[model samples]
Target: MARASDVFTEGDADLKVLEVKSWLKSRGVRDFEPVSLFADQLTKDTVAAIEKLADTCTANKSSSAIKKAIVKGIPRQAVLKPSHAVYRLQNQRFALGDRVTMVQDSGGVPLSVKGVVIGLNTKSIDVVWDVPFMSGVTIGDRCSEYRGSTVEFDSCLNLTNPQFVASTNPKAPATSIPNTPFKPRSGPYPAVRPAPGHIGASGFRPAPARFVVSSLDLINSVL
Candidate 1:
């Protein structure tokens, strides 16, 4: 029995074509060796088929699949609306610190976020959360008594507005009155008093006695 060497190995089983050819060429054995597995002669067709199969089997093996390049650009109508609520809430009727659950609807699902009534408005109770978008609605829940297990503060005015400080005891300081226009016109004014015992200076006139008048008449007669 002719045992199967690598040069004449098997039928339908592929061999390292280069190894066999190189070994044969090195040994100068150009003539074919006898087949052992199926007793078929090594022909050009079989060799060519083997080479073609080897070429097909050799391919790129990659760890990841090749991805196509995508071109990206911003759309013309893209806009960022206000996504989160921006007000803190408190209820005037509720005590200062009471826990209230936030609700998606007026009485809908009680949200996970809780709210301490930080503030309240006539319409809505404000809340804050690590979250921003509420059910993807641009206008959030504006109903009274937010339902949630978590809470947040939104408006700066709620905590800092004058309404929060309405109970302040300090009254507004009184406005100082501006100085008068004349500002107390004062200095030494003229004194208009007459002599202490004298009557009216314009009404005084001296009267002559009757004897003085007669003596004046006799002197004139003697003359």
Candidate 2:
């Protein structure tokens, strides 16, 4: 396996033998000899010193003061430009129903307005603000109805205390009918009469004809 000093040297070429000796001296490693004379002792001490430096660097990098220093060292051009149109197109994090706050100057004073995104186009976004800014206007009035309310997508900034608006499309109520138990037929008293010369259960039978004797006796009495 490669020694720790070898790994450290691979990262930083400025850490020379003299700097390593100085680091060891600061860490209370006395009686330092040349690596040619005491190779094993010098190598062990150098590794320990490099390890200590690495730990110190890590701790310093994590500190807020060192972090500020590192940030200040970075060029202004390296910072992300949120106002760029191309950057806004590439990283479109907002959508319809997302609440956004826009910072603008009104009457030479900075004003912050919170609104919901109602529409989106190629170059701009239409927002409907919840709070009414105009005079004689009631609360919950849409801001887009007023002039100069539309904001460019690049100029808009996401609010820190973001509250996502719910969808306007409501779910339709169910119209399904419930199933009912089957009911039997009721109130039936009629009996079916069979036709004449119809076959009975025993055998087939002929129907009887009516008598005509009363008409002849009545005619003889009248004569």
Candidate 3:
């Protein structure tokens, strides 16, 4: 079984696949082993093609060359559909309808303005601020009629943002109950009452009983 540290992210999967295959080949047992032996394989052919494409781009370094590389690199299963892509910053992830707040002031929007995520892509998230004033809709534009703003992942923090300490809420003031009288109980039961009998080996009795009668009791008493 693999530990959490042994796991690889999407960016590292291709390279790890290549390394695993190379190691297997070095051991001289390639004919029986299929590519499916490793999970998350982009396939050896796909890795080779990507390497070729990268080399071509590095050599040419022109707009036309880059465009040609992208054209050749398109996935074989490509289809037109509404993208449900998720974006990440640090350990926090952004998706549609996730609540977020601005950490820095930009354009007309002020810091700590709460907003809902309406859109997201690889680089940034589009938030619709709850404020009445217009906010910037793009990266560097002044202001737009839109209620929210577009900000880079680093510019805003999400509800579960990992950058700050988890114990504190930035919006709320810290409070303490000064000089509290409450304390934890020592034990589950109340203090034990003294037993009705005498103490061990001690000849002491608590007291002798004494009685006094009132006049009314005397009048009703038998002679």
Candidate 4:
């Protein structure tokens, strides 16, 4: 907030008064006006004198800029900080997306009110917090060690513990020997042999094999 007298003293710094007023109008300075004392001082310098006067007026209007800025609230994202992080809770179990508290000063304190994990590595995890101001957090303030804690989420309600596996026999060979060739040999059947002849009361041949025939000489003599 350079005063009229203050601006005139720094002649090279402050340009002129009327020009300053116009600059203010362009910037939407509603009630801007040039101080008469400043205008009279710049009247002595006729070469670009009005421009100098405007610059002086513009310099004095810094207070107005401050006032306008005060009317606007702080930016939402500007306040909430986000950054990479490394943390471990009890037993050194590291996992991505594990929420954490950022410490007030990374070197001094270990935990802040709120933070969350967004990345993971073999031994380190990346975290992001709603508050950008918490970027000062360091490994010292955090818990390199903590209690044995487990996640209480409901998404894995039906999950079970690791189980032992047992392997089964593999598939048989694609080609194999025929079953008939491998079977043991048994003796031949007895049906091919004929049965002994049955005897009748007259000791003659049975009717199934009976036949009648005589020699030619016997037939001729009989005739």
Candidate 5:
């Protein structure tokens, strides 16, 4: 008859030494010296020794039950270290001008606040939110506008949940303001001759007045 340890070794191929230690600790199995000594290579003899030790710890539980307990003691993937989380965030390459959404009240109710990535540090990111802080604001207030202000990554939302919107460049055509007229030229090599009244004594035309559009106006137009 195959022993319970043999069944476990064949069935759970991914089992590790740490998991064995965790399982022993969870069950208060104090006689762990033999198991710990041969943790790297848990042969049939080692497993039999461990089974004997486990029997002394819990008289009522069967070897199969001990196997189940060990399986249950496996650490979850989500239980990550702080440094690992930060390393993951750093690998994302979140740069300035990247648009990101901050998720608030994620557990009970989710609220997504839009912001632009303005700065980055070793430990956190700096975001300029499209809205200001307000009292009693909830998920329903996502569309509500406020005076734009900056916030730290940790303060605004969990670093793990920052949803990427779009990365932008100041010189990118998509981000450039529209409806700004081009200035005419007046020199001998001018691309386009200046209009009759706009010509200067130096034979160069002055640049046209730039029409700056407010961000609020842009948003309102889209709506």
Candidate 6:
């Protein structure tokens, strides 16, 4: 997952604070407070402003909008981080409501931590950690470290590989073609013969004699 700041600062383009506010408003985020900074601020300040706006969007469950703002605001071509949440979801092959066990410890999150995927973005995968955060220690909202690399877990259990099984619904019986012995035709199917004096199966017919003309006879007639 790309850091929110990294995502905002991609393409090496700069943005005015006012422009950032405008983008937030367009993303249905109207509650962010604009920083009273210079119209021409440093790259870091601009990224900070965008990250703050992203935090507000995350709070409002509009995390995906942050990337949209970045796309539209950046004048130069911006590349989505390879480890972005969308790609990570595909590579990891785990999904919302899946039961997963952490194989290795990450950050302060212990081994065997389990959680359900609640939200995901370019930043991180938001999970409702099975073990809740404690007092005097802030887990900072059960999110994985950048690109969800830290929080990914085994989707399957350790004991055995999964096996395919038939459905047990009696109402929907299993159906298959019968195994009766039969021989296929050795040649192409016989063409249907057209009725006597009728058009052939291809529906092709020569022009009538009255409409036919020979080039030499026509030239002689014209002469």
TM-score of each: 0.16, 0.25, 0.30, 0.19, 0.22, 0.24
lDDT of 2 at 80: 35
- What TM-score does prediction 3 earn? 0.30
Task: In angstroms, give how far residue 183 of model 4 lies from its true place.
Answer: 60
Q: Give the range where candidate 6 is weakest over 10 consecutive residues by summed lDDT.
A: 156-165
Tens-digit lDDT track for model 4 on 67-183? 433424443322323222211111223233344554223332234433333323333333333332322332222211221112211111111211111123234223221222111
**For this target, which candidate reaches the highest TM-score against the unseen true structure?**
3
Can you list the residue pairs that collide in candidate 5?
Answer: none
TM-score of 6: 0.24
Model 4 worst lDDT window (10 residues)? 154-163
Q: Model 1 Cα displacement at 193 (Å)?
A: 64
The candidate that achieves the highest lDDT relative to the unseen native structure: 3
Model 1, 28-80: lDDT tens digits are 89855333341112233433343344334434434476577864553322211
Candidate 4 wrong stretches, greater than 4 Å: 1-90, 103-105, 108-110, 134-223
lDDT of 3 by residue, 129-204 (tens): 6543554453222222445466666566667533333223444543322233212223323335346663434444
Tens digit of per-residue lDDT, candidate 5, span 64-86: 66443333432333233333433
Candidate 5 wrongly placed segments (more than 4 Å): 1-91, 106-110, 135-223
lDDT of each: 0.34, 0.44, 0.49, 0.33, 0.42, 0.39
Clashes of 5: 0
The predicted structure with the larger lDDT, 4 or 5, is: 5
Candidate 3 global CA lDDT score: 0.49
Clashes of each: 26, 0, 0, 17, 0, 1
lDDT of 2 by residue, 109-174 (tens): 125555555445445555555443453121122222232245565455556332222232344333
